[model samples]
Target: MPCTQKVTDDIVWVGGSDRRLALFENVFPLPDGISYNAYVILDEKTALMDTADAAIAERFLTNVEGALAGRKLDYLVVNHMEPDHCAMIGEIVRRYPEIKLVGNTKTFRFMEQFFDFPLQDRCITVKEGDTLTLGRHLLHFVMAPMVHWPEVMMSYDSTDKILFSADAFGTFGAFHGPIFADQINFQVRYVDEARRYYTNIVGKYGPQVQAVLKKATGLDIAILCPLHGPIWRKDLGWILDKYDKWSRYEPEEKGVVIAYGSMYGNTEAAAEELANLLAQKGVTALRLYDVSKTDSSYLISDLFRFSNFVLAAPTYNNGVYLPMNALLHDIAALNLQNRQYSLISNGSWAPISGKKMDEALNKLKGMQQVGETVQFRSSLKAEQLPQLKALAQAICDSLK
Candidate 1:
């Protein structure tokens, strides 16, 4: 164990892992160490928002004890049921047997499925437009269905004006000591990760997000507390503005994201040639993401901007490359519509990547495929030169 350290006054960040150790699923490595953020709100009654993983479970208890001092633990709220957030529930329940568990119907279902915890009949089940009062702090629970998980709901405080957003508005980095966003330069370090988290996890729930936003409009928000990364206290409006844009699937600009997976240089070569062709066709705003090397964050951030997406890859073992497949799965989950896409693929014997890629994308709505599937084999052959040129022209035509 690396040992735990306290980071903030009310927010005690309790984790001691280096950048390489990713404690949370899909979390980017932060140099300061990954903090499994579990907040202790000492109001008329003490309330804890989301517990840490099993490893940091002990430290989480310590933080709660420090916060409670003479008071007893009153409640433990699970915002997202993903194991990283809910893994320590059983232990916490054992320690604080009388502590009330807070969540909705979906939360209990997942709680049973994940650890077989007996919380359904015992805990407080809240629905949309419900409020729980803790002395001066009034906790309002809103139904945020499918913000990554079906059981997920977020709690907000009218007195504190804090939105316990679960995974929403989270950034990827070392869990900094200060819990507030004003203490860190998230625009430089965290915004990209937050975008990635949205695209990869919550993008499919755009409709639910609309509902969440509608409910949120009625309340005033000052601080946004997520299960991961720093809190948003400074420039709160900036984050809300970004979330509003992201949840609506609005692209930032008219650009193209050329993402592909290449076994050898041949598939990658075709991608490069396609990029040049797109440039020649006057699509100057081009961003190339090699799915094999680039992190999911950059890929997601690009997707939020470019209206057009292109995937190029070589058929591997009679299928698309795994990285490209994962990327496509994440993109499709976003339920994005009205985006034009092109495909370029290569296979030595049977070029199956293109066909599979097309099938994966065809599942998305309002997606227009450009021309025919451009094919190449082994290496970029002299015979295949014309095909790349044709593919370029097809992409240009789609942009028009």
Candidate 2:
């Protein structure tokens, strides 16, 4: 039996979720797995929006065929050329030989490069304002270069006012029956995973995201159909607002994320002490992470969520700890900015991690070093309590 959901009277969700995959793109940790979304628009001439990952190709193909109900697939629109979504292009063409594959020039270029399929006469190259008509439904292609990928494009359905976003409004985590955002507690359950997905995967292309958002503002979009996660049919503004803030590199909440890396628990002790001090000072929503234990993907999500950060790590061989250094490198590489950060460095003999960490953070844009660096030898001694308290106070003040 095919597992699918109806997005509207005519639009059917022909996507599937993969809960067994440990990592997405062999990088980010997927604790709750991920969903690959694709849609089928039923009209006088049927069209499939995109294809799912190869991991779930069997179920995805069944869902697509089931949704079509024996109606031949007229067009297959290529949105993003990522393998996760585009892995089934060859399979789809093999199944539907007469189907017209619609995409931009770059999309075809990447398609041929990724696969050995001959796409000479099968390709329908479109441009920025290109429109494809399928009786009552008309899809207008909006070019979204580097909104993550160069060949990325979004199709707007003029008939139903639905925006077939490739991966712009996507999130992590597999779907559990309910296909619409309004059906579940999206904020409580999926928001963090969503933030993790965006900040880690698409965070670097903030400017390109902003450009697409600007282009979308001119059109009236009633539904948001992304390549992952649930469809946004009810509260479109909620997700749109998140995308706007995230693309601008703005923090969602005014709070602190304390990430520490410890060798023998000394640096961890200092991190805990500062967190307790902040809590006693009435600081709510404080997030603490062990950089050595927690994956950098999760840390990056919190770093993007909170406005303030307190990084505590001990020096090793006259340099910053390996895990902490990796986290900072990822933060900078992802182009994260417009946030305040404090540092706590521990060294048994010579303290250089503080200065080294500061130098690494300095390479980023709009990152401010708050308060004096709290340096302690071996462990956080009683003499440094005042310094820790002062750093905590600085973080709290920045929150306000």
Go through the candidates in order and give the C-alpha RMSD of each one to the true structure.
4.0, 0.9
Candidate of highest TM-score: 2
User: Clashes in candidate 1: how many?
Assistant: 1
Clashing pairs in 2: none
Q: lDDT (CA) for every model shown?
A: 0.75, 0.93
Tell me the spans in candidate 2 whose CA falls farther than 4 Å from its real position. none
RMSD of 2: 0.9
Report the lDDT tens digits of candidate 1 across residue range 1-400: 2233333344344432224555346454333445456677776777778887666666666766666676777888778888878888888788777899888888888888888656644689889878888887788888787777788899988887888888777765655455667777878777776776676667777778878878778889877777777777779778877778777877756778999888767778878888998788788989887899987656876787677888888887789888998888777766776678888887889988989999988888778887677877777887877877887787777666
Model 1 scores worst on lDDT over the 10 consecutive residues at 1-10
Q: What shift in Å separates residue 203 of candidate 2 from its native position after superposition?
A: 0.5
Which has the greatest lDDT? 2
Worst 10 residues of 2 by lDDT: 391-400
